[model samples]
Target: GLRNYVQMFTEDPRYWRSVVTTLTYVVIAVPLQLALALVVALALKGMKRGKAFYRSAFYAPSLLGASMSIALVWRAIFNDGGTVDHLSGTGGWVNKPGWALLAVALLTVWQFGAPMVIFLAGLQQIPAELYEAAACDGASKWRQFLSVTVPMLSPVIFFNLVLQTIQAFQVFTPAFAVSAGKGGPADSTLVYTMYLYDRGFVASHMGYASAMAWVLLVVIGAVTAVLFRTSRSWVFYASEGDR
Candidate 1:
């Protein structure tokens, strides 16, 4: 009933916290991941040597990052006295609420391989003649990138932005595995999906869980709609002619 849905917000404190955490994760992870991916894509596009090796090496993380095993590996690395602690000469990060989320964000950013590859493909499709013309007009390399590379690749950038935003909101494995399924350390790592799982399965409040799921779906749809609408200003399709 709609009453149950209302209670999800009014009666639930954890639900709101989860919402904040999820949004924070999306805000922090998606842009950083996309930016790093773009840099990597640009680097790969300019490389004349070992491109294949570098591409494979960079992309390997996205292939295995979402797996249970990799999540466990992430947990170990962030846990007390784990690899990061050993390397940084500090105590465990995963046990803390603030740092644990950052650790998870790092893991998310590290899996930028998929978008990087897509960006590389987009870069390859850009016409080289445009760059030559820009150079002839006395444009600097930076100016050329701003004028040519960005506009040409805007479509691809929009694609990755929308896709990664959706993916970021659905992040569950990292929170689940890294927090040991409890969203512990004071539930700071508890994401939207994790809270939904607890409500549906652990707490046996399936109705609330359903409400949360529907809300999430609506949120994603609305965000996507907004992106598509605003994209007319920024996302330049090739058919629209050069801006």
Candidate 2:
């Protein structure tokens, strides 16, 4: 049992590559998704008409995000000479090592509705008087966003970041479906969870996969703990003064 654990790290260079690929995916996908979500939430917050319809339309993709059918659809779009190719003229995305992971990341980004709703709720909870005060003090819109909106929304942002980061770490289906379960082209989309699945189920390295599973749990816990630890510096509570 323990031998597999030690050998997984010591014996396989792919373990390190998977770690790098996983982190890259998380870094690219989570921030972009949250940024897009926040932007959409802000736009929705200011809208006076057709809010429900627009929200539903945007969120519908998230409902189908994890489905195999959507993944297949995404594959079709990003494959050689597909819709995206016709628009961007960038050719296919999933067949090139440099672009395959980005295609997978984009699939995750397209499902930003859940976080957008959460951000919208947070935005709604913020007192309008705060923005009024900022404006009264001659703050520009950008300054007001930084000083008022971000501070007020920090908690919600942190919440989304944690959830998204955790979700990104477990990403497998999109990569699997897009790459046809092979983690190609050239293993660019071989995220940690996919590699774990490959080792355990495909290669029959159950012991190694089990070891990797425990490590992943530990790494996630440690990352969460680190985020909490560092959050004290940036995450502010409205009741902080009471402490």
lDDT of 2 by residue, 114-188 (tens): 999999999999999999999999999999999989988999999999999899999999999999998899889
- Taken over the whole model, the C-alpha lDDT of each candidate is 0.92, 0.92
Clashing pairs in 2: none
lDDT per residue as tens, model 1, 1-243: 687578658878888889999999998899999999999999999999999999999999999999989998999999998999999877778898778888888889999999999999999999999999999999999999999999999999999999999999999999899999988788888999999999999999888888889999999999999999999888888886744
The C-alpha RMSD of each candidate to the native structure, in angstroms, is 1.3, 1.3
Q: Which residue ranges in model 2 land beyond 4 Å of their true spot? A: 1-4
* lDDT value, residue 84 of candidate 1: 90
What TM-score goes with each of the models?
0.96, 0.96
Clashes of each: 0, 0
